[model samples]
Target: MKVLITGATGTIGSAILRHCLQEPSITSIVALSRRALPQDISSPKLSTILVSDFANYDAALLSKIASADAAIWAMGTTDANHEVNVIYPHTFFTTFLDARKNSEHRSKRFRYIRINGAFTVSDQDRSLWFFSEPRKLHGMSEARTLELGKQYRDVCQTFVVKPGGVATSGAGVMECAGKLFGDGAVIGAETLGAFVADLVVHGEEEEGAIFNKRMVEKGSALLKGNK
Candidate 1:
């Protein structure tokens, strides 16, 4: 499978990048980011591209990225800033959807997986104790993206992964706490990466929202299977 990944330099994104490279079924990958990836990470199946702006995609660039079989978007803001949270990702989603309309690859399904938070609330009018505004704004992004996917369900499938707390590799303490109090609210970064990579390879029929508990279950199963 050929895949494209954005925000490949981030915490979760980087892990996804590494895992994707390790997937034998993934024959090709494109890493689209604002900056270059780490020098230590290199693979025959991986390619990197730097973008000056997320919202500004020229025809050539859009055409290049639109050819991929799937895209993993990890570019979101902590503050839920309007541009990064909504506009940037939405633009890319629409761009890919539109580009596929006139391309021959329309015969294939395009998978799009976006990283969201476990606390995100899609109901605009819902109440919250803290970070209400930011969650709502992020929710707006999620709702918009999902709506678009619904509209173009014939040719594309979209998924949102909402992880409560992402722990790095060998997060012993975090794992213990999550087992005791998380109720599947937390997951390891490597585990999340494995799940995301599996989605790209075997998620031809999966869609809609994915929660932390589900991801943990799926990811753990995938890691064990690969071993």
Candidate 2:
């Protein structure tokens, strides 16, 4: 299957890209990033596109993206850029959805997997003054994206993955301790990537949202062929 990945240069995104490259079922990859991917990673199935503007899409980019069967959205930020967290995703989704409507692909549903934080609030009206506004904006972004998914449920299938603090490599002692003591302490980037790739390639049809611990459990089960 052809898959389009955004934010391919980020931590989890890069890991996901690597995992997708290794998956035999994935025939092609369109990685969209602000900069070109590293020179070390090379594959005949992989193509990288430099995207300077997320809010606006040219015909060339839209046509390229329209060919994909699925899209993995991992682009995010901890900063106060509401545009990046909220507007950009909404724009990207609408653009892709429109393109899909015009395409003649055989598949009825276009899968969209979004990477979100564990703390994101689905209810936009819920009050939480303790958290920063920027963080709340992330929640808003999630809510807006889900809304679009519902609006176009007939054509677009959206899945939101909420992972806790992601470790790029081996977890430290404190991180391990947190994992043992806490509910959603942290998860390895490689593990997250593998889990997401599996979902894209082999995930069963069911719910649309997945949390951190459940992500690990389900992903592990899929890897073990128990799912």
Candidate 3:
């Protein structure tokens, strides 16, 4: 199976790419990026497409993306790069729709897993609302993601991954502190990456499914059985 991965250079996106490379069943991988990919990660099964603007892609590129069996949309702006809460979703949705429109595989289900934090729609719980304060921009950014999820719930499947604090490879002091406190909620980058790959390659019946870190890992394993 061929898969397209956007934002293939980012931490989480790269992790997913690495995991996909190790999967023998995956035939080829197309990575869409603005710049050249790292040389160290090159492989025979991989191809890279340099894209200037993901929000708008030319016809040629669009057609290519449209034909792919599936795409993992991972492009996003961090707080340091862009005013995430206000602008990230606009760019994200525009790119997502463009990808869908360009996809050649008509029935090909696009599995979009948005990385967001824990949030509830209910306002009755004021305590939870505070949790969204410090991360207001991030929270608002995810709201737009949810909007996209609802919009494409019928045409395509969208799942939001709400990880509290991501724990990377080296257990830094911050990560250790988090682990010590009740706020130690975190998912390793590699773990999250493998989880998404398992979902895409082996799980199609999981369409329109929303999953957490734990659920992603579990659902991926379970879906393989039925498939």
Top candidate by lDDT = 1
Question: For model 1, what is the alpha-carbon lDDT of residue 202?
Answer: 79
Task: Name every residue pair that clashes in candidate 1.
Answer: none
lDDT by residue (1-227, candidate 1, tens digit) is 88999888899998999999998888999998888888988998989888898888888887787678999998777786999999999988888778887887888889889998888888999888999988999888888888988998888888988877899856546656777886456888977898888887877355888888777777877777853
Local accuracy of candidate 3 as per-residue lDDT tens digits, 115-199: 5554433233345535444355555556666677677665556665665455566524533454466342555666567677776
* TM value for model 2: 0.89
Q: What is the TM-score of each candidate against the true structure?
A: 0.93, 0.89, 0.71
Q: For each of the candidates, give the backbone clash count.
A: 0, 0, 4
**Which candidate's TM-score is highest?**
1
- Where model 3 places Cα greater than 4 Å from the true spot, the runs are 80-104, 118-134, 170-184, 204-227
In model 2, the Cα lDDT at residue 64 comes to 73
lDDT of 3 at 78: 45
Better of 1 and 2 by TM-score: 1
List lDDT for all candidates, in order. 0.84, 0.81, 0.62
Worst lDDT 10-window in candidate 2: 169-178
What is the lDDT, from 0 to 100, of the residue 59 in candidate 1?
83
Query: After best superposition, candidate 3 residue 28: deviation in angstroms?
Result: 2.0
